[model samples]
Target chain A: MATIMMRVRQIAGIALYLGLANAQEASWRSPVNVLSRKGLVADQISTIWWFLFSTASLVFLVVITLLLIALFKKGQAVPKGPVQENSSVRPILYLGTGLTIIVLLITAVYTFISMRTLAAPSQKPALTFEIVGKQWWWDVRYEGESISANELHIPSGEPVHFSLHSDNVIHSFWLPDLAGKRDLIPGHPNSLWLQADEPGTYRGSCAEFCGVQHGKMNFTVIAEPRAAFETWLEHARAEANAAVSEEARVGQAIFMQQGCAGCHSIRGTAAQGEIGPELTHLSSRLTLAAANIPNTTGHLAAWIVDSQSIKPGNRMPSQKLSGEDLQFLLSYLMELN
Target chain B: MFRGALIIAGLAVILHIGVILISLERVKAKPPLAMPDTTGRVVSQEASSLLKHYGCGGCHYIPGIAGANGKVGPGLEQFANRAYIAGHLPNTPENLVHWLMNPQRLEPGTAMPTMNLTSTEAKLIAGFLYGYDNDAR
Candidate 1:
């Protein structure tokens, strides 16, 4: 029994640790790594929490011990009425109450201060992002350009403030190690902040259930050094600004030939539909189908072949295309450069 | 006081255990939710019926049928006649065929997934679509 309890505690601790996402620490099946300064902050906060919990527990144990002693002591219970003037109880009451208030006030202030410290508001506002929560996926936008689907790469050591919102139901964005949880509501916007103190990747998941694929709706945050992040951002901006390539040009014609533009978007192309995530940087994303499948040609093909198999009840419909058409379209997507 | 407290705690524990057991039994007795319609894979039926079965009518305003109305997808009444699938795809029969057969194949980045259907089934469904030309307006 003791071993079982210890195992449970160990499992829970690992779970809590994994819950904290940092970019460099590559967790299980996670593309992001936990090697970041935010990991340190999370550890610090966890320690503080444990310390406070232990202290309060000690106090509770001591009080309970006193109560048990009082309950079973040698004092003869005089079957009495309401004693008006209890001499010993009054001072003890004042002392206990005073001590409790002092403890509460101190602990409350400390917690508040720690939270404020964790919520780092930058002096210069180095980074900004808009995180949109859909049925189960995330639509992340940096500055004016939007990168669809799974991946988020930001410069290391820069605090990024995120404005989170939802399209349909309410969802929550949580990267426990990086910062905290922020809710995404349909009509309103909520905000949270996180910054990787070093170069790393961190795993994040939907803390709130938006729909059927909520459990599978996970994303990553990559905290790259200044140069790497800048290069990535440059590529993203280029993808946003780029025109349809020659290789994809014929495929683009075919894209319209098939009426795919009705519900999807590719910047600089005729497909500007908003019902779906932007495909401007489709190839750059780590996963497709709102994070349900990994972003690869075959998986993309399978998901496109059978979406219900991947995410049941999503609004997207299935289409039956010829193998040649499928190849051309897949090529066009891979050529999203 | 100690004896009384012990007796009360024991009774509370017993009641709590009983309630937990009863709740578990009640939960186990309930049936599961019905399996969803699998017609998403079947496109041999009429496009109208398929749309109805799939609940596309709930959010889409299909044009040909007078009563079939929904706002989810673009109004499909003249959707068949539209020149493009998403925005820029030239509305052509073969193109619509491709679009119908597999939309994601053409637009790797679109939010619309490739609805599971054989190429022939897509072409057959596209057969009912007639409004892609200028006459639908």
Candidate 2:
């Protein structure tokens, strides 16, 4: 009885472990990896995809049927003796050619109609955003406001206009759940419009191959109600509040003393380096390093010590600081919100 | 056919050379100004390593430093003759040291990062920059 109980307990533990593992895997794939239709543009694109897929599948089935008939039908086989033309051969050829033309013309017309619909510009946009692609990151700026990076906040049920530009090389802005990918070309300005139907966080990526760290260049689009979006924007536009705690104050000093301010800018303080992302109101963000890691104190400290370890070839250099200084800087950055 | 190909190649070479000569003339129109050692101070040779270790070369262009041709920040060539540091602060030895050590305090939104350098290191770097001769370029 004792051995049986022990065996049952071991099986229960294994079952629990497997369940937890499955949950973790599901969370990783949920909302982030799926091709979603959470926005107006995405909905339209999804419809077009369905239409194209069904039509292609029909064409594939028809071709396969013809091939099978040609292979298996004894009557259609090559002549072993004298060749003779069948009465049905000419009509079959004519019918097949006419059907192919009709199908192709229909597919072309549908494709043109979808293209025109997607390309039509919005009459009036509720907000305008300008996103400039850099070597391996994004510089996102709202019209006539302070610049932010990696994350964009927009209001649900409202059309938003985006003007894309590239500072160095070509990079494509793709928010698969919100809109189509648009190229950001140097010396040329391209625009797109998108609207979210509900409140949710959608992931975006740099679709074009830009540089060494292109795969890691990710961003988030947070959709909320208009009132909430306005509130967030107002707060983002203002300078960060002063450090309140003694530890935070020490971290603030260390931030300036250690030259952290040279590459990252925290608006209320003197750390105004433009080569990297803006860190003002950083605590409010869910992730760091362009969503490569979660925004926890441990992750932030690790990133400061060796950014290359987290995301190799990123512009932020690895820093060497004492444990005390590192703790202080982490505390200071956490309090920026 | 061979003769025609040779003439075409010659015209291509001439066109390439003509483009190069035109660009070179354009580059010569504005010559870089000379920077003199106004303070007559000597910088330690160790300052170069300090600059590299601190990642100063990751943003600014400093002469005689390997991998220091970063275009993010302005070049340090003829830095002493410039009337201002960061386009605002007066060019003085003391000001340069202060700016190097704590740039954010001096200018809030300036792109120059505040490197946490010791007073001695800041002085050494400032001396090297101020004493840079344009002839080296």
- Best-fitting candidate, scored by TM-score: 2
Report residue A203 deviation for candidate 1 (angstroms). 1.9
Docking class of 1: incorrect
Best by DockQ: 1
Q: Chain B TM-score for each model?
A: 0.51, 0.65
Chain A TM-score across all models, in listed order: 0.75, 0.86
Residue pairs in steric clash, candidate 2? A262-B113
Worst 10 residues of 1 chain A by lDDT: A21-30
Tens-digit per-residue lDDT, B1-137, candidate 2: 99999999999999997886654432221112222322321122345445644556545677655545555457887777779987788888888889988776787545454546788778767766765644443
Error of 2 at A264 (Å): 1.2
DockQ of 2: 0.01
TM-score of each: 0.58, 0.63
Q: What is candidate 2's lDDT per residue for A236-275, written digit by digit as tens?
A: 8889899999979999999988888888888877888887
